[model samples]
Target: MADGRVDFSTPKGGSGASRAVFAHFTLRLDPDRLTRLRSPLAEIFDELAEEGPSASDDVMDVTLFTMLYGLRAGTES
Candidate 1:
């Protein structure tokens, strides 16, 4: 496990549901790889940040799944 923290915050009005939702996570990786991973991760999180309250649950699910799939695929290459 690499030693570091990555944080993500939603924009003031971007959260989808009326109820509260929270996500906190830690990723362990080589320090040298952190810089390479940050940009793509940020891009994924940025998409989530732009999702409006009107977005359907299915859409959100797919978006999240796609992010994970892409990351896995990238790492396998």
Candidate 2:
């Protein structure tokens, strides 16, 4: 099986807020499955933003998830 690694950061800011906040995360998963999940993940994230407190600008929303690093390997290193 092929493995893929994703390292990303999510920007955090509430509407009209000037301060910048960011959260970083790294995830390892099957590449093929990750590819298949792209669309669905996007939809789910969007839905969460739209249906949660973020919709009212009362909470910080992850406006962007920037991938900073990635690696793939046949075995864990």
Summed backbone clashes in each candidate are: 0, 0
TM-score of 2: 0.29
Q: Could you give candidate 2's per-residue lDDT for residues 1-77 as a string of tens digits?
A: 03522223343553554454466777786777677757676787788768866446444434555553347567957
The models' CA-based lDDT, in order, is 0.50, 0.57
Give the alpha carbon lDDT tens digit for every residue of 16-76 in model 1: 4433344556566765577677778887678867964555653332224322222332454
Alpha-carbon deviation at 17 in model 2, angstroms: 15
State how far residue 66 of model 2 sits from its true place (Å).
2.0
Q: Which ten residues in a row have the lowest lDDT in candidate 1?
A: 61-70
Best by TM-score: 1
Model 2 error, position 57 (Å): 13
Best by lDDT: 2
In model 2, the number of clashes is 0
Model 1: CA > 4 A from native: 1-32, 57-77
Q: Show where candidate 2 strays beyond 4 Å.
A: 1-22, 41-65, 68-70, 74-77
